[model samples]
Target: MSNDQPLKGQIIIFTGTPKSEDVFELVEQLGGTPISLPLIQVSEWIEPTDEQRLMTCPTYDWLIFTSQSAVESFGLKMKRFGVSPDAITSQIAAIGTRTAAALTKIGLTVQFIPTVFSADVFVQEFKPTENETRRLLFLRGSIAGVTIREELPFDVDEWTVYSTEKAVHNIESLKNLVQTEKSSTLLFASPSAVNVFSEEIAPFTGWDTYKIGAIGHVTEQALIEKGAHVDVIPSTYTLKDLVLELIK
Candidate 1:
């Protein structure tokens, strides 16, 4: 193996849909073969009430976004409803840097981001400007946790902008890869993806055969709960960071 290619001959399988192709290219640049075996699929799931809420999103004091999918779905909804970015007067808060970037792509400025990407930490650190009515709107996926809504002291309302479902079609392909590969690294980005893999693939391939890389502490905890040994977890909760940590 060349000195520049730290991941030479390594097969790294991404278990979630990477937000950008740069993550894949980075692995290839480092002399690793990157495989996409997405275990979870995300799609827009907007209801009439959700649309109404989104149309009047400016009325809220703060807008909270935790995932890029939510931001994408929200951007689509804004286009559908003819809601301009200039129409929104509410300040935005994102859980992660990627989420903040997505919100920025849609012409919204993010005013706050938690030190940690997790919602539990977000609630503790995020502070909104003092107002008489501290009403916040949380745009989230269908299966997202209630930590932000339940823990925040403000009057927080939630809108399900997206839905997450297991990508069962990839299971057979993942099984084949696991069976054929002598050694591989599996990267997990979300707890939902971990749950799906734990339920469908782990029973067939078992956990010990592969090295696990989790994007964040939440995913690491999920893997640990499923009796999987995590080999790498980056200090930052991003795919690029996870891949960099893997090479190290």
Candidate 2:
């Protein structure tokens, strides 16, 4: 590795949504050529007539937020509904530490979070007691899976507060880059991103020289299911951690 630019001659493509400019900057600092090929984008989903009911009612025993996007969308909708964050007196559950932090910043106390940051682990460990009623409300993205719903043995109401759409981008530049570069690395952050890439982008050739990386188990599974070979996955499920692992 070159001391000044360990990744100086490398090329990397980021295919996830909600990308951070800082991650690209970091890649440049490490001497890698970073490509912005975001395969999916998220938008808040709003339904006025049905959402209006939330402003006047606090009927849920628990509120679940699985992603930071979910937290942001829920916050915006709550404001539009005239429902304050504090007005919902239900216990809060977050899927990951980042989700918990996002909720905490908005003055909502998080009551539960799994150690593994996966839906399977969360439901297995945080089930309601047999006598207790679990009238949980899940605010999530349209593409987010229903693993919690499938695994949880209780009543849970889910509402899609955001939609994940395929992001449109010109692949010509990426194709040119692939042809010229010796090899490249692609990073995936979620299953939805993997699906978008497989469905919309993978048909193109020239990816044989590209290495693939996923953030964690769920994303890795998507990669496998899509027949994409994963070359790396961080022990921890975080972008920062993934970067560090890649640099290693």
Clashing pairs in 2: 8-31
Per-residue lDDT of 1-106 in model 1, one digit per residue for the tens?
7879988898999999888899999999999999999999999996777668877788888899999999999999999988999999998999999999999999
What is the number of residue pairs that collide in model 2?
1
Best candidate according to TM-score: 1
User: How well is each residue in 112-191 modelled by candidate 2, as lDDT tens digits?
Assistant: 88777778778888866665444778887887777867778888778888888877663455555555665688889888
What is the clash count of model 1? 0
Please count the clashing residue pairs in each candidate, in the order shown: 0, 1
| Candidate 2: regions farther than 4 A off | 128-133, 170-176
**Candidates' C-alpha lDDT:** 0.90, 0.76
The worst-scoring run of ten residues by lDDT in candidate 2 lies at: 48-57
**Among all candidates shown, the one with the greatest lDDT:** 1
